[model samples]
Target: MSNQLVAEMGVVFIEDSEHHFFNARLAVNGKPFTSLLTPRRIRDFLERNNIVYRCHKGKKQVNEEKQMEINRAVARHLGCLKRPFQDGSPDPEHQYNMDESHFVIDLDDGNPLDFVGAQSVKYRSIVSDRSSGHNNVRAAKGGSNARILCPMLIFKNKKSSYPILNLPDTVYGVYYRSSPSAFINGRLMTEWLQEPRCWGHAWPFTAARTLWMENASGHCESEVEDTARELRTTVRLFPANATEKVQPADRFPIQRIKEHWRRLAERRNIEAIRKGDWKTGSASSGKLANPGKQLFLNLASECIKLENEEKDHNSVDWAKKSMIQ
Candidate 1:
């Protein structure tokens, strides 16, 4: 099979099967044959010329230094919190860990085109599930179903050395606008601050206590810091560029929630398809509803609920049961 070369100008040229190189023209016009070259030169040039490869798909590590400052604050707060809970303790209350998570939602409404890999290993098109019967076949609308966001915090009982997880009310939070300002609102910041307060929740407490949090963009706010100072609560910050290795949420549970959430979304999509197929002419009295739209709404609702629950729990609960078991 011949390889196709999309030139810098996006003029595609199909090479002959016998030729390994797909002829690339340096310029779009003016003596095309003179500018013809092999793909090897282009590949070699791009490799040697490129600099500054970024991880996480070109995402810039902005505010990293400031983030470290927040981590330090969190660490200091935790130290204060743990003092009373220590064996020969000083304070017996107010300590916890808080962090956020990210997830990817994969839906089945629109099947992607197939692609062939090296050694002729071909990927197949995903077919819609049919277990629910003919009433479910619906057109795919390109969109996500849901996201399961969690702000997890852990609490401790100094007496028993027992720990409980404080989870928020909803599994995910929504951004009304794409701008950062919209997502980090007053309500969210308040919740983030209250996570270590041990406020209005019944749970065992260690004789000594401490509050801990990573330097997330949402939590590292001036307002929260001022509030912490006024409340007499200590905020401890982790070391710079060390969240991936230290934060419990980053280390555990967040990944599991995403996997579970994706499975749930896929299953819900299938179930919705089974319930709604109004186009099929069957019983005049029994027309199906729009499953695709309903699926999105349902998934969105679930995500919102999970996020709220997790947030609420972070502020209130002392511990949570492990989802793994």
Candidate 2:
């Protein structure tokens, strides 16, 4: 019966697969196969069939029509699809994009260093009852120019239980803020725009600047728009459900940052274990300290270092070409 069910499922997956398998109305022999599908069993079946699940292929949201509409709207807003860039090209230095991404200190990407042909490998990290810290990162990049604005980092307010001692005002082109929700809102948006660490440095480049952002409630607030206009900045909101295609930050840098952050966190965990800082038998159950502002600062610093290195290499190559000319 199970074999028959699996065959039916395979057919369903091939013929009329939903983006999410769980959303599909799966059945066996004309009856709903409501048994919980365990990962182990799924893996077993796939191994038997010599089917390999490609981890690199990411799943997208099932909103094709909505995404298409969003793409059209973004093109219209950017004055690109119907118009030529030469007619009204925005200054590279004045064009910026910002977005937020979250990070969980205890969550690893599940990449295990297991021996070949092992059934499974498991690693553990300190689990907490409270939610993982939120990292509201904003990646601001300009057009043709290679300049990148400092990324912003926001975390939940430090409580006595999760103490962060002697936090610095700024760390290596990244600004840190502690908020109740660790999310960007209209008020926080206004403050970030006005802050010297962010748009303040770009003031000399252009009198009027444009910022591209998603249609989040915080970015869409009327007050936020009013504030940007007052600051001689124009905030362009990306069309609903279209950020994946249109937002430059979402395209690359944000993912890189998250990847680097996870690596740094893993290294930190390993080091803690080596130093005996994490007591496996302790009452706390050997969970490492709640990753605080400083850890994020280090992650941001590493990202900046890598970006600068790449930019410098590109600059050198350009300079060599100029000399040849």
Candidate 3:
């Protein structure tokens, strides 16, 4: 008999196709669900059982996936910046990598224990936390909390303290802040370019002779192009989709930097909740409370040394192996 006929008759049978006899005891109604034994029979069983399955899509998941696409596009744009100079221009004596980053400061509205359980937000499972339920707003006051502050860091090749130039006549090489206004420009750019005291002697880029920069609107304007001409230096733009491979900031060390920033932010949040240190405005302000700035300098000066030393040791080992072969 066909398997379909056997199932319709509600009788259990075991038989080899080549064998004549079939034998098995069948239960008529004692089963909650049927189990299929054959590996190839899943579709048949599922169709017979009328089962339904569900999939979930979360907001954060969607946002992160979308952001990854955007990152790829941005990386491509940065890669294009590294192309050889088109005009066959001579290489410039100096070059710099420029970028901006954002930081945050938590504001207190008298809510210290504002955390809701993670799983509770999604209907996965319930985790009732008594501490998270407590209204501890009055407990977190006097915190040195305020608006966010952000500062741009410039990494240049070769050791020098050149001031950032301000070019009002032409729009190239203007530095921008998160705010609406330009932070640095014009004579500031010229002076900084000429001055060898500000950003000179920085590692990695400090040793570089040719500078590479992205084509930010402010940097690529005709005036800034003119400025580069006067300086007798060549500017090379990276190819699109290649920043992740070339830019030092996009390289391995950045993850370490972000991890450190997260640690600092968590510590500050704990401190603010425990003591009303800044509510009265007596706590440190401006440059002092800037966690991002502090972390960047510390990593640049000290932690980077450790990383470089390790890289050097690895390089030496690789060279020795190549010689042995």
Candidate 4:
């Protein structure tokens, strides 16, 4: 009966009666039963089942109509939908998906290892100076041609006194502290979109391009829209909470870049240990060396190169089914 009640709770019809039935079954078995279910016990059960709770405050709510509109807009932009406004959708080469992701200098949480009866373990690392580092990456692929734009890296530093000397000339570095959040703001977005390096090399002669991005405040600014209009690029905003499902960048490219970065960082740490650059000490005293800005640039560049090479191998598949294509 307890099992039956638990199974019923997993279904869609859980209500007061279900709870009462569960309690009655417990009472029949001469076990303690209560009128109200304990939240703590419920959470414990969920945790045992590998389910975690997250607070979804201030999340954008998209109605069915809005979602449908978003779908139609995306289809039209991809040349899959017949619409007068989208008569000549830009080819894949000219269509780009852009997004920003934040990475920390240190691991956010420690990894699990083979251990027995241990309360905790400690790993030493340099005190992270910058907790918020932003990378704005753009991925564009059309048929057999795929181009990964040189990413824009934003460090948490004053714009005037940013340490430009620490970075390589190949990677674009911006020193702007984002307010209230780790992501970039409207002014910075405009500045980045206006940069010649972003669009000049990819489509030098083609004025008409399409940019798909999430509906974040930074991406939806009036200035950003005006700049896109001036540059002859149409900006399309994805529906709220829909980027992970629709945006190609979010689907694979961004994740690949971060994975590559993690691997590179691990290798760098190993090399540092081998070279005695990293100091060894007790858990409370040890300090691990942090990769500098130049290393970050190198990792980002290598990831881009790797993705570009992989894209070449899969270009035929992409050409046939890619929405951007």
- Give lDDT tens digits, candidate 1, residues 229-274: 6555556655545666555444334544444455555554344434
The sequence of per-residue lDDT tens digits that candidate 2 reaches over residues 190-228 is 767777776555553357877777888877888888878
> Tens digit of lDDT per residue, candidate 4, span 104-208?
755423232223344445544432334435454454544445556656666555552344554535554222323334467787677667766655564433558
Report lDDT per candidate.
0.37, 0.58, 0.33, 0.56
Clashes in each model (backbone N, CA, C under 3 Å)? Answer: 59, 0, 51, 0
Q: Report residue 304 deviation for candidate 3 (angstroms).
A: 6.7
Q: Give candidate 3's TM-score.
A: 0.36
Measured with C-alpha atoms, the lDDT of residue 167 in candidate 4 is: 51
Query: Please, what is the TM-score per model?
Result: 0.38, 0.65, 0.36, 0.62
| Model 1 segments more than 4 A misplaced | 1-93, 107-182, 185-187, 194-209, 275-325
Q: Whose lDDT is higher: candidate 2's or candidate 3's? A: 2
RMSD of 4: 15.4
lDDT of 1 at 274: 47
Native-referenced Cα lDDT, model 1: 0.37
TM-score of 4: 0.62
Supply candidate 3's per-residue lDDT for 150: 18
CA lDDT, candidate 1, residue 197: 23
For every candidate in turn, the CA RMSD to the true structure comes to 19.2, 14.8, 22.1, 15.4
